[model samples]
Target: MIHNPNNILTAGKPLEEATKVMVMVHGRGGSARDMLSLSTYINDKDFAFVAPEASQHTWYPYSFLQPLQQNEPYLSSALNVLEMLRARLQSDFNLKPSQIYWLGFSQGACLTLEFLARNPMRYGGIFGLSGGLIGPEGTSRDYAGSFEQTPVFLGCSDTDAHIPKGRVLETEAVYQRMGADVTAKLYPGFPHTINEDELKIVNSLISGQ
Candidate 1:
């Protein structure tokens, strides 16, 4: 099922009974099961979690900073998977955009931010861990639509080898321009891993506090 949306893993509350839903995306080389582990930290008992596995556990073949076309059909396919999942949640579960949230790490984070920017709306919240928007520095961000004040959090290491702090800042600016309530933080000299402080923030966001 390469690039297919059928390979999905779910946890937390059953979809029929869930009041909130969070779509979690794993990074390159990561699996749906790995992404589901985050629910342990999210600790949102009422949330229904959905995680889609990518082909070969990777979203795109090339680096996100590479020219957009270089990522080709894989990038587009990955985005489409998200679209399908969103529609599924809405139609099947009677969930609204405001009842859904998104979280991703590294490559997954890039895709998450790109999707939100391309399809702007008011979501429960968005959390990008250790990542930034896709494409090189000069990629045109002329994306249309507004987030309508959706809460977005982006956290990364200042010296991350894969994600540059500059890109993280640029992503924050872009989301802000699109009317998202964005919060971005750079941990000085930190490793390329999620930190407890970030989890705290996520819990707070999930709690709507």
Candidate 2:
């Protein structure tokens, strides 16, 4: 199963002593170690970071915008990995849902946002860099549950070749409707990568500022 705990990489404070836990999902072809490296930029001493390695270094075989069925069980399997990870963090580490955070980029960001949409709850924060919810142009997003004012940040390029601006706005709307305090920023002609401003916003969240 993709949920194997051994496949997860950890960094920063030990979970047992951490007051907050963050799950970092890596992009396509990225490794768990790569994600853990982001903890350096987050720079939160009291937070425990966890990142899962996707089988084959790819969460799915097709673009996230492809029809949901086209990605097959891979997409579902990837989501299950997050589900199990969350469960373990809560049960084993005794972290409440509000103490958990989520962050991802590109394909990984899509997966992370999908998981949050499917299973809504109060979280420390949710950061999606250069990505939007999965599925084609008009997929149904009738996800249920409230975020209880959980802070969420969506940052992407207005001209991102991989992620359309429209989809990012749609994602913001979905989260706002679900009661998340959403912040979306689209940079003009920005490349498909995270920017310094995005990092500053995330850092503010991590610092509780």
Q: Pick the candidate with the highest lDDT.
A: 1
TM-score of 1: 0.98
* Residues 75-191 of candidate 1: C-alpha lDDT, one tens digit per residue: 999999999999999999999999999999999999999988999999999999998888988989999999899889999999999998999999999999999999899999999
Q: Against the unseen true structure, what C-alpha lDDT does each candidate score?
A: 0.92, 0.91
Runs of candidate 2 exceeding 4 Å displacement: 2-5
Q: Score every model by TM-score.
A: 0.98, 0.97
Quote the lDDT for 126 in model 2: 98
lDDT of 1: 0.92
Candidate 2 lDDT over 1-209, as tens digits, reads 54354699999898899999999999999989988888888866888999999999999889989999999889988998999999999999989999999999999999999999999999999999998999999899999999999999999999998899999999999999999999999999998887889999998976873
Clashes of each: 0, 0
Which residue pairs overlap in candidate 2's backbone?
Answer: none
Error of 1 at 178 (Å): 0.5
lDDT score, candidate 1, position 152: 90
